[model samples]
Target chain A: MKIKQISIFLQNKKGRLYDVCAVLGKNNINIRALNVAETEAFGVLRIVVNKPDEAVKALGEANFVANITDVVAVEVPDRPGGLAEILKVLADEDVNVEYMYGFVEKATDEALMVFRFDNPDKATEILKKHNIKIASEKEIKEL
Target chain B: MIWNEKFECMPAGELKQLQGERLKKLLPYIYNNCKAYKDKLDKAGIKPDAIRSIDDIKKLPFTTKVDMRDNYPYGLFCTDQKNVVEIHVSSGTTGNPTLVGYTRDDIKLWSEVMARSIACAGAEPSDTIQIAYGYGLFTGGLGFHYGALEMGLRIIPVSAGQTSRQLKIMQDFAPKILGCTPSYALYMAEEAREMGIDPKKGNWKIGIFGAEPWSEQMRTEIEQTWNMLATDVYGLSEIIGPGVAQECPNKIGLHIYSDVFYPEIINPNTGEPVKEGEDGELVITTLTKQAIPFIRYRTRDIVSINHEKCKCGRTSPRISKIRGRTDDMIIVRGINVFPSQIEHVLLGIEGTEPYYQIVVDRQKHQLDEVEVLVEVNSKMFSDEVKQLEHLRAKIKKEIESVLSIGVKVTLVEPKTIERSMGKAKRVIDKRQM
Candidate 1:
């Protein structure tokens, strides 16, 4: 299953992260899971939000350069080697992982991980073949 | 295509002899008319008769922008106020602007050289020339106008701004030649596309761009965008505007009108002449200016000179496209910017540190953009995102107020910018031009 993720271009300056949150908050859009990837001059603020289209619209209205990206979410056992086992499968299948982030479900012994793969469709097929549980948009939005 | 074959192709020896005679006459004119020159020559214990040959030009004192500013409006004019027909003032960044007066003969000489410059750029009397350089105080507009008129070319003096109107005029008039800064030319191309007109498919065949330093990469971009031959033309108000030198269709270097203007390359720091073909500061002396002829005036522009005959059959010396300015001045979108001006703005703000770097880049749209990377104190860096953005906005506003140029202010971590042992590198120009 594919999840809609928002990637924002932020100059490496003060208040950019807050600005993104303020825009989302004012529009009543909630950020489900977020991560910041940074370089020397700028950073990319990525978020899995409840309403991605709404969040993108709100962020764009606030003058933020935001784009929609497709990512996949998977559920793994909440164990010591949970991520390692899934990563090894993708590596064996020759599917590259650009970046990934995750959060654990509160009531289940399973952790939900989001992945940005080089080939999302192939990665989804490989995970399905390996009987790995793929989380849908409803599951992520509910979280 | 050489406009003045007799003078442009004169033998080196005969040209030097003519220069020597001109210098002999010009020295006496300066010593008698201008008090500042008389005093300087008297203090140096030199007389006008002592200068016998062109080599003796080295013995004369060097004039600078400060000398011109100190004298103000008409102190340096060799002719009487009644004889001076026109005056052009440079847009000085600070204090008083330098004034250049011209008599009727000087205007005729400027038109002659500019006509030659236009010919060098491959424009003929049959082509229609569209001038986009700003008019009034700036020299680019009128200089091209007079020269194109002198060459009997059809003229459309559009001046700068109004992108939509400019494109409409271009499409309607179908002018064959374009004159403006290289950046504006690129900007107009982008606008033309938005207006549903393809610049490459348009009627323009040649573009003469100058008034700012541009790279060969920009030349390629302009050429590819418009599918036309793009050439560089060099000039300054302190000299005789845009006709002092121009790049021929060969695209090698700008041929200096050596008969009217004598060019010398000298070490900016030591003031000693450099070997031919060596890069150094450009010093020019007006050989035929009537109102205010300068003798070995330091142009402050860095370039190398080539004395070899060009493929265009012009024997006059050619100067490489200006590499950069000897001073700290940086040209962004045709506007001069100084790091110290940015520093002044940053120092006034509370959160900013003394350390900052000005990064200049040419965007994909072909216009220049300036970014100021400023280091902030630890407190400011750790502040809430809203506060940090407020600080950036404040700094940008202050800088725009002082420099009159829009800039992107980026707050960097303290000590993030590399420090140097001696002179700090305050500017990073990413534009290849």
Candidate 2:
């Protein structure tokens, strides 16, 4: 129903992203999908990793401010109107999407999307009622 | 209770008469005793008898910090070296430090004024005063120490640092009064929480903070944190230290012991006296200082003075809390800005800690740019990205409205900015100018 995403607070300085990656890599933590939402001064590095808990601990030990957040992951058909159809469903159901990002699966004609909603539990319930393919924690972990 | 009622509550006319009499005597003393003052007065075409009344003080040559530096160690001392019992030096962050010598009588006078200051802050003689200002050579520690002793209060002369020891004394000694810079007081509050002690529940009832410019918001923060009256004490080492002026419990303004030190506000650039209640550089003349009396000595502290009767019932004129030093005003893109102004704006904003650093840099060797790094609290950090961006924008707009200069506002994590046990450093000017 929900996937674990790690978010890190990064100052807008050179080599900070590399430093975070190095810390996770050294700790044998794998980053699956990542999106860097930034402003002029700082950025929030939202990452879906193999082990969200381990990633948070490793980042904290490296002196990076990080936390674990719950996000909804879904599998969408790799077609032109797939995202538009999902947006229509959310709009009709009155569910709000705070932010969303996705990656295309290399093994099949499918796209994996991560979404942060105003209410994750309600969003999961509404998407399930619409018969959308909701990716579970185990599914995202395997990917 | 007002101390020295005879002088503190002196009527205006009688106070002027006393000042005239003191000025008349001070002119001759400086003319005959101090060679430096004599030379300056002689060059300005003035003699000892030229000062007929207090109003004629304007004709006398003004003294500047440069004069003190030129004289260095003891050239300004009006009395012989043997008569001088003690000395205190300015921190001299810029150029050579100015030296001030005090006679035994001068020290006694300092203690009396400091004791009066303590009384103004609502501290009783029965209360124990814990002084945290640095001891050696610094005026803050010894100044408060002598004053508390003069007031018959038990004093613990624990000067600055060693946070653990400071807390231990606070817990065991149960002092009712705390003395230190405003920044250090805040630092101690934070440290106390870290050590699992609730400062608000402690025995401290009053805090006498001084030696640096702080905003009213900072005052509120310290007061709320320790559940004590955080009163501002005004003095400089060039003057008699922490006893020149003090804010009454009313917190309106700091009452200058004008019977001892005369206060005036003047234009920093033109050196002309400004209208009453107008902000200008503060100038002081020691009416009773014996060892090294200053005549219209330019303090370089920017503030305004109100001669109206205060709610505290003291007729002595009160000076507004220092706005900023004349030299501390940074010129960013042709607009004058004070770090305290930025602090005021930041502290007023919700979800912001009262901690900030202003960094100014020259871009392309021409234009000036300002970047304000503000510390974000847990509430602000927990907000969504849009809300955080809105906060940043709101801060930038507020700063621009007040400073009339655009600035980049960066929301930094808590504890990212350096905290000081003494004066908190607020600005970092990377510009070559």
Candidate 3:
């Protein structure tokens, strides 16, 4: 299912992650799942949240560049080679995953992965052909 | 000969008159030959016919490094490539190299200038010249090699490397003249002493060091160890190498061959030529070069000039010892701090002249920190360890006062810092932009 994700530019310095997350916590934005993509000096913090608009507003108020991007959430078997299976399926269908990350889990049911791909349609088709289960937008929204 | 070079030693009026006539002649040749110059002249609305004297030469746009780079590989050469017997290039770290073409006469002139420099340093035809400079694209080695040959000296083209092998050659060959960078000469001396060989025991009478700017203190240190008169040779690969001007035995300043190369000191910021004795960027206008003619080529070297006669009996115009270049100055915290300024501070502080490193890193988003790593001399004493922090603090304060920038001084052991064979890149900027 598709969900809105916020990207935060953070300097590659100690406590930079803490500083951003601190701001989010103070603003009452619960960070669902996040991953940091880094170069040398700066990094992009990709964050999934309960309220995308509110989260972005909070981050913006704190004087940072925050933008929302669409991403998909997929449910993979919580076993060996689950990520490999999803990767193989995507590779076969030629869906270039710009980035991917795992979300925080409460139980050992299934691994929830967030993926950004060049073509969302191609990703959905590939996932469907491989019998990969995608979390419904309502399910993610409710969760 | 070309513009009566003898007039260079004459009074100011006669010299200016001769230069005016030469500039008048160079004007037409340049206007006809160089397309870039022609375009610039056209843009400036300057007619070559209008420039009848040296004063008129000032009206023309001065050619600079950008001009050379803009023209690239061949556009700047006045003569065709067939007439060009040799080509030298500046180290093009950024992009395309600044190519300098040398015709037959140009090569001869280069050799002649180098020979004159060698003669000024008390080198003779009978001296065994060990050319320890780097060869292959670098002009230091071959430039001196040609000059030594031209001056009828025995040339040993042992171009740069193998400290032990070089020492062994020096031991057996007993070369009277050593030609290389000043730092290499010092390293060689240190190695010789370590190897139980005295550099003074050899036939080495004189050492000519260049390809890098150094202080009189370095020359004194080298002279003390090698027991040879060490002289500084100055040149740029863009013009010619290691022979544009050189320090005579008087050791006051470099005697520029003003007859062939007309010089002007210009404020780097303003681009206006400074008055005589004023400190500014040294710019040169090649008066008699055939292949790649340069007019007012801005060399960023900062130095004062003295036009008066030297005690060495040569009336050639003199350039004071080069402090550093405009490009070498690093802007830290909005302050222009030269590495030489740091060196001056370090040398002033009692105790050490050892190898050092300068670290530049950005801290706390907007702030920059400078950490200077200098070696602690042995005489600091075992008890001085407690006082080391205090010493470092004092050093930092002194540096801050001198360069007007806060710096952290890190005192290291003697020879702790990495040593370089050629030019030492001691300053490292770790700030990620």
Predicted model with the maximum TM-score: 1
Q: Against the true structure, whose lDDT is highest?
A: 1
lDDT of 1 by residue, B205-234 (tens): 899999889888889999999988999998
Which residue segments of model 3 deviate by more than 4 Å? A2-11, A36-46, A51-72, A78-101, A115-124, A136-138, B1-21, B31-61, B69-76, B91-96, B126-138, B154-207, B216-230, B267-273, B323-433
Over B65-178, each residue of candidate 2 has an lDDT whose tens digit, in order, gives 778868887888899999999998753323345578899999999999999999999988889999998786768899999899889999999997787899899999999999
**Which residue pairs in candidate 3 have backbone atoms (N, alpha carbon, C) closer than 3 angstroms, thus clashing?**
none
Off by over 4 Å in 2: A1-143, B93-95, B329-433
Query: Interface root mean square deviation of every model, in Å?
Result: 11.5, 2.6, 21.6
Q: What CA RMSD would you report for each candidate?
A: 15.2, 17.5, 14.2
Candidate 3's residue-wise lDDT over B92-158, tens digit each? 3223556788899989988888888888787867789999987766688889988888888998899
TM-score of 2: 0.60
Using DockQ, give the best candidate's number.
2
**Every candidate's lDDT:** 0.84, 0.83, 0.75
- Model 1 chain B weakest 10-residue run by lDDT: B378-387
